[model samples]
Every structure is written in C-alpha cells, then in structure tokens.
Target: MDIDLTRTDIIKIVQYAVGGRVSLIGVNLSGLDLSKLKLSSVDFSFACLKNVIFSRANLCHSKFQEVDAENTIFHDATVSE
Candidate 1:
C-alpha cells in the first residue's frame, strides 16, 4: 500500500517481472499513474490495479489475467488482444 514508484523506474519492475517469468501477480498498484508508458505484453495476473491511470499507454497484448481493476483507467490506451 505504500509502494513508492516513479514512471522512469517502473520499467525496471516490468522488466524484472518479465525476466523472472512473472508480472504484476497480486501486486498492489493502487492509485498509480501509468499513463503513456510502454507497458506492452506485461502480465497482470491477480494484480490490484485500483484507481490506476493508464491513459494513452501502450498496453497492447498485455495480460489482465486476473486483476482487481477497480476504477482503473485505460482511456485511449492501446489494449489489443
């Protein structure tokens, strides 16, 4: 609940997740502003994305496998597949 992450550093998280063959599994990303980021193909299974803003972000082919997407904003975000 107190995860302090910056936009620049978030790619590290994503890379770590993917590198480890895991991604956003049950992560509490509440109130995060992930807008206009290159987050394509990242897995979000069982993650908590409450109130997260992903506006205009490139989420193409990213997995929302089992997420708590409460109030998550994907406005204008590329979310194909």
Candidate 2:
C-alpha cells in the first residue's frame, strides 16, 4: 500500500507503526524531508531513502538492511543498537 504522504503525515505514521511489531518493507520515501522524526523498532528493509534529509532524527532500533540511503543526510541523527 503506497500512500502519498507529507512530511508530517510520515512522522505520524511512523509513530503509530512503532508500537510493537511493524514491518515497513519496500517503502519508498525518497526525497522526503523527514528531519524531525523519531523512529524505533521499524523494519525498513529495502526501502529507498535516497536524498532524504534525516537531520536530528532518532532512528533507534530501526533496521536499514539492504536499504539504499545514497545522498541521504544524517546530520545530528542518533543511530544506535
């Protein structure tokens, strides 16, 4: 299910989908301005984040396996195990 979502909408959706078990495989959020997001426990395998701005975003416990984040900016982003 591909949805045309704004930056704010993406933030809300990510928040809601992180409650427990959420699989976000093959999601294409390329070129989106997700600079103010706090994502956790979400599986973003094979997702396209090309040219996406993730400044100051909290991406704890999020899986980025096999994802293409080319040209993505992670300025001030806190990534951990």
The lDDT leader among the candidates is 1
Q: Please estimate how well model 2 matches the true structure, expressed as its whole-model Cα lDDT.
A: 0.78
Clashing pairs in 2: none
Global local distance difference test of model 1: 0.79
Residue-pair clashes, model 1: 0
Each candidate's number of clashing pairs is 0, 0
lDDT of 1 by residue, 1-81 (tens): 764455556777766664444356676778889998888877778888889999999887788977889999999999889
Clashing pairs in 1: none
Which numbered prediction scores highest in TM-score against the true structure? 2
lDDT (C-alpha) at residue 65 in model 1: 77
Model 2 agreement with the true structure over 24-77: per-residue lDDT tens digits: 688887888878677666677998888889899887888999998999999998
